[model samples]
Target chain A: MKYGIVVFPSKTLQDLANSYRKRYDPHYALIPPHLTLQEAFETDIDADKLTNIISEIAKKYEPFQLEVHKVSSFQPINNTIYFKVKMNDVLQNLHEDFQQQLPCEESKHPFVPHVTIAQKLSNDEHSDVYGSLRMLGVEHSEVVDRFHLVYQLENGSWTVYETFRLGKD
Target chain B: MKYGIVVFPSKTLQDLANSYRKRYDPHYALIPPHLTLQEAFETDIDADKLTNIISEIAKKYEPFQLEVHKVSSFQPINNTIYFKVKMNDVLQNLHEDFQQQLPCEESKHPFVPHVTIAQKLSNDEHSDVYGSLRMLGVEHSEVVDRFHLVYQLENGSWTVYETFRLGKD
Candidate 1:
């Protein structure tokens, strides 16, 4: 199965991301707005064993605050625009933890925690959107208590396989 | 740290169990009523890695129906009185999955999924309580959507480290 792990932002954040996504993101229909923790990867491991491992990893961390402070873009790299989530020790550690623990290969791109609002744009369009969104900016914060282990469906949409809560008890 | 995996029944079931626990189980205050999936075991693995593994395992199974039909006792073996949970393929498979995947010794007893209501009774007390509870019987069913990975605190109470939802999406 093809699986990935992610943190879905709150409805308020989702509404904000969706506002931009509806106009700019091609993948707006494929997934809810989320912060990708692990890029999608194929794995042959049975689901039972896989979830057990994830449950163990989730037990270590407490709920942490997630903050999105501004609109940003991966301009020269790919023209992907996003809500740049502020990186803290908890988020950084979680990203690194998945990288080290999951069977998938290390991500080709460096971890930049973000909620992509627009992607696959031409340079001009990217510049137009990025400039306006950057000025309008964004400021949102919420506590993230859990993350989902999700799988792709035949229809090309993502669905949650399970949600693992964060923290020891 | 010492950790275990278990399913906490719904409030209805918990209250039922607690009523009996208050009088019969000596370890009642130590933990809530639960159906154990994995026994407590000590592990040196970091929390991140452990939760990841657990999360992966949880994603495999859909929520399954749990039914406790009668009160029973582990007679000649011991004085552990419990509500006998009917075993189905889903529960059996989950138990086997943990045994095969988790880093723990094989359980000394065979898997007979149950929610303990009493234990550590004397021969006479065992007979008295077992006779009364078994006659009272129990008939309850609930859909279990999640299971918890829990850790023992310094004071010895069990606390949830994380809760992993069952099923795809």
Candidate 2:
């Protein structure tokens, strides 16, 4: 359990989470899409523990672009559709803000932003998501200047933990 | 559909969409989050139609804060999230742009500007999403400039369609 901004968009991400809720837990409400200013740490980690981490990371960053996306699935096999932001330097640096606050030696994969489309699904559901996506192919790209903090509950759905926008991307 | 522009900070949105591809639909991915000049029409559409609608709406806007949130969701229902530009004169004007474009016979809904996060969730799958949301609770807000245009495909994901940034907001 680490602390960082989990970027998701407005109603779209919430709706995706809702899809999971409708299917599985029945309690998976979502926050908003955003980036983090903290780094990876364990669960329930307090913000007090992160002050130093955030400062250290911020000290190094001047605000860079947090790439907007990377299409992926909740699970490869079950493959529910989902799109998320790229964890570029700006995003990583923003996460570093929280990561630096954590105590030394935390074991966790680094954070990358993502908008979950559904809970884990098997073959048939996977193809349905893919089918929908196949039609919406990429036409262009844009910029993101904000970061958000999010948390995952036992149900495995993510909620808005926090959000911070940079002065510049 | 009524149209409006949801402005993202910068490249952060672009990267998010890029990352979304890694796990979701790798083929045609989402374009970056941006200001949209058109709405989700009630019927087929194109840029000419959108521009005509937007040009008029643009005049009504006096410029205001389009607070960028982390993400908003559409799912189990839509399985998606997006950044909501805090409703303002700008958003209203954008929406007004499209409203004017609609044929007198067309029905319209309130227009809003925000980015998409996820989509395509069947009902039975996301029943629990309600309670799942409180977890995300917002943490940050950002001020942004510019409106981006993006479109979602039959697949139900979005890509940057175009961008129109206006005076400070």
Candidate 3:
């Protein structure tokens, strides 16, 4: 199975992202609004082992605030738009810690904590959306209490395999 | 054994880092100046297995240019100074691919590709050096042809276990 790890945004943020995503993204219905921590990799790791690894790391991190700062694009490189995450030591540490626990390959992309908005657009479509999203550089903060481990089903949609809570709360 | 993956800077860059590192860092004499891709992790995997994994991944990447742009610090979090890497898709992809191949735990810090100038400084010392380094930023670019897998000896110093070249070059 192919698996990835992510922290879904809060309800309010999810609703906000959903609005923009539904209009702009083709995969909006395929997955919820999320900031990917680790890109997907092929793994046969059992659920129990996955649960234990995530659970152990979860205990070390208390729920923290995540601020979505602005919209950015991978322009000239790829046709993807994302929400720029405010880089914080706590968040960086959380990513690093979880990465250590998982029994799969780590992503090579420099960890840019972001919720991808739209991808696979025509060049014209990307330019159009990029302009529209510039006005969407709003600041939204949320208390991140949990992260999910998800896997791609045969239908090409992703489903949550497990949820790891932050801290003891 | 404990292992790490890194790309050693070119000869000229190595000398440049070595000069600054020797004066500021205590570990300069202990290890060469190199950019770490993976921090040391304990593993029982044999060298042949490690080589095979790395070799397979290397074939997917063609040699690319890497630019070491400026100086940055982990101050207020940790006492370390590094050359801020210019984030690019190729380098990011390389890191993500190599990470997936290794059998070990990942680090708890976001991967910032840098040549360390100094570490283990007191807070005040870190402040002084950070100020000095801001004006000392120098841009250097080099073609990245290969990366090395190294292991720490019983004496706490690291040695190369294997070298994996990118593409056929």
Candidate 4:
């Protein structure tokens, strides 16, 4: 889409994912360690469009901070996955922002933000993947300063398209 | 060349040199707000050769934990620019682990690792480049994990050749 927000990891995230993978990717077939803020879609986009959107959204949002919690996973519904992110008010607010502005209204499942490490496979892939992630071990909560705009390409791979400062109007 | 890590956020790194062009294309830039561990290399690579190296290397590494810290930058020399990673003991250990087996040697730049956000412009592009980055307001000091083996393609783009687990070994 022309514009949207994405939540993935910083390069340092690879470190956290690797630690988690050492333990999880081997034993658990965790979805690769990435949590998307929302699915990408084609839309009319650009800085002017973004600036207008941000200004419109900010009018109602004063600004707030949230804490990213410890590692957790999704159950048998999909593949097991591990993620690190702010799960409280900050996340809820961002979600609320999307629902008001985007198509998140169509998601079949509730959004649970995560940064992916391993992905798509049977139980067989876990032993190696999880073991690798485990070696990386657990990481502490990190701060989130901005919201990202990412695009999922034709090949089913996701790439960040752009970013926006959340509290700044 | 056969075995190398290109670092994460390489997706839009092409934007580094094209800094003066336009902000519309984050495609040439690394994913916004990510940290890199090392200045990854583009080595002699082919899928078969790279995969073989990975399959062999994967078996050797075991996962480990690291303490990630604040944002820093590096100017090895006046003209050279880099995002600097803090040196923690655990990180040092991981560096040694990687150095022993990988085809490329660890950077002599004291491993002040970082997933780069932008390229330091040549003296020629300096003024215009900094002006652009200031408007972008990129953030740094990211946590790291899962070292990826990426392929820098002929079209001046990067594709993840393979991602390797470090601690799971």
Best by lDDT: 1
Error of 3 at B43 (Å): 0.5
Tens-place lDDT digits, model 1, residues B48-144: 5777887777788889999988999889999999999999887888788888877777989999999999999999999999999988989999998
> Chain B alone: TM-score in each candidate?
0.96, 0.55, 0.93, 0.53
Candidate 1 lDDT at B167 equals 83
Give all TM-scores, in the order shown.
0.53, 0.37, 0.49, 0.42
Per-residue lDDT of B73 in model 1 = 86
**Candidate 2's residue-wise lDDT over A61-137, tens digit each?**
55454333445554554464545566576665555544454553442645645544444566786667666654653
Report the lDDT tens digits of candidate 1 across residue range A1-169.
7889888766567767878887899877566778998899888886557788877888878899999889989878899999999988777888788888887888899899999999998999999999999999999999988887766654355545566778954
Candidate 2 residue-wise lDDT at A49:
46
Candidate 2 Cα errors over 4 Å, as ranges: A1-4, A8-28, A33-45, A63-70, A74-80, A95-113, A138-142, A150-163, A167-169, B1-169
Two-chain DockQ for each candidate model: 0.03, 0.03, 0.01, 0.03
**Model 4 misplacement above 4 A:** A2-4, A8-10, A18-34, A44-51, A58-69, A84-86, A103-105, A124-137, A156-159, B1-169
DockQ of 3: 0.01
lDDT of 4 by residue, B63-83 (tens): 433222332333335232233
C-alpha RMSD for every candidate: 16.3, 13.8, 20.7, 18.0
Model 4 chain B poorest 10 in a row by lDDT = B24-33
Superposed by TM-score, candidate 3 places the C-alpha of residue B95 at a distance from the truth, in angstroms, of: 2.1
**DockQ-based class of model 1:** incorrect
Q: Clashing pairs in model 3?
A: A105-B100, A107-B96, A108-B92, A108-B95, A108-B96
Native contacts kept, each candidate: 0.03, 0.00, 0.00, 0.00
